[model samples]
Target: MDKAGSEKSIIALEGWLQTPAGVYMRAWEQSCLDNLTADIFGYNAVQIGMPEIDALAASRMPYKLLADRKPRAAREQQRAVNLTLDYTELPFASQSIDLVVLPHVLEFSTDPHQVLREVERVLIPEGQVIICGFNPASLWGARHVLRRVGGTSFLPRTEELISMPRMKDWLKLLNMGATQSRFGCYAPACRTEKWLHRYAFMDNAGSRWWPYLGGVYVVQAIKRVKGMRLIGPAWSRKTAAAPSAVPATNKRREQQDG
Candidate 1:
């Protein structure tokens, strides 16, 4: 999608996020992100898109950068951008970033694969990336399908919501192994907050009964570089040939002189 179109779509999605369904998903995502990132210590952290929620709010990283695809006015955004650049082409140096949070960015991205590649490129070895997205194998996903038949769809142009399995595959290809994953927004899609509150019990029930079938998911993955070794002190090993280094003839001569 063109830059303008991408911006427009995200704006629409942001608007949807203010509604009852969006609020339901947003609160769940916020809690997940908070718990996941709170204990992570890093020098640099960046959050991509989803200005509605601060993905790194709980992180104690010295520097936090909020980036979006386009330039947004400060007053207009709840989570304003610190940098405005293309998602597929991040300007940061290779292996420079410590933590990256991507919230609902992949589904709407024009080149989602390249975006992941860019994330892999900027992330330092062992650095972490948290990704949040809509789950296609859920009731929310089914609603999108049903609504499409009526010549209307409430979801942003994310026609193909990426599933957990597919997301795992993408991470594996990037060498970013998923360490932890959580699913949220268990309640069915509802148009009003009253209906949403009525189904609030579903959240706990779904978590225990059908955790993987939630409407949204958050995955935390670490960038793993091949051939990387752990940092530790070098311990010297005493060898069997150590005593042989002292010439036997010299020892014998010394004994005879004595």
Candidate 2:
């Protein structure tokens, strides 16, 4: 998708996020982000998209930046944008950012692989990235698949729904290791708030019984870069020489002289 097309997709997704099901999904996503980001200690952090939820709100990073392809995005997300750039090409220097948050950006991006590559490029070694997205293996996903057949779809039609396994593969290809993964929003797809609240108990059960089946998943990954081991230094380390051992008779004579 082009810039304008991507922006329109985001707008549609945002609109859907206001619905009852979307509200529930957002609450779950927000709670998960808060818990996950609260303890991530770092100097710099950036939330690439989904300014709607303030992905880094719980982060204590001194330098926090909100980036999006769109201009300003109305600051409606309550957070101001520090950088407006394409996900495929981040303005920051390579390995400069400590943390990058992507809230449902991959499924919406034109080239999710390039977006992830950019994220990996900007992340320092051992830097972390948090991703939020839909799972194609859940009830919500099934509903989307069913709706896709008809003219009306539950989620944004522009989305190219990706499974968690596919995402893991993408991150792995970028040399980013998954450190933590979570799934939530187990309730059946319900358009009304009342029905959604009715099935809230399934959240706990789903967590224990069918974790990977959750509608949404969050993956926390760290950029893994292997360091080369220096075998020897240019200047050799000094070594102390040991005195040679003498025969028993010579040892006695030396003791007497002492």
Cα RMSDs, all models = 2.7, 4.7
lDDT of 1: 0.88
Per-residue alpha-carbon lDDT of model 1 for 134-233, expressed as tens digits?
8888888877777768846656666368998899999999999999999988888788999999999999999999988899999999999999887654
Off by over 4 Å in 2: 1-4, 73-77, 228-258
Best by lDDT: 1
Q: What TM-score would you give candidate 2 relative to the actual structure?
A: 0.86
- Please, what are the lDDT tens digits per residue for candidate 2 over residues 50-114? 76787888999999988887766455545667778888888999999999999999988989999
What pairs collide in candidate 2? none
lDDT (Cα, 0-100) at 174 in candidate 1: 93
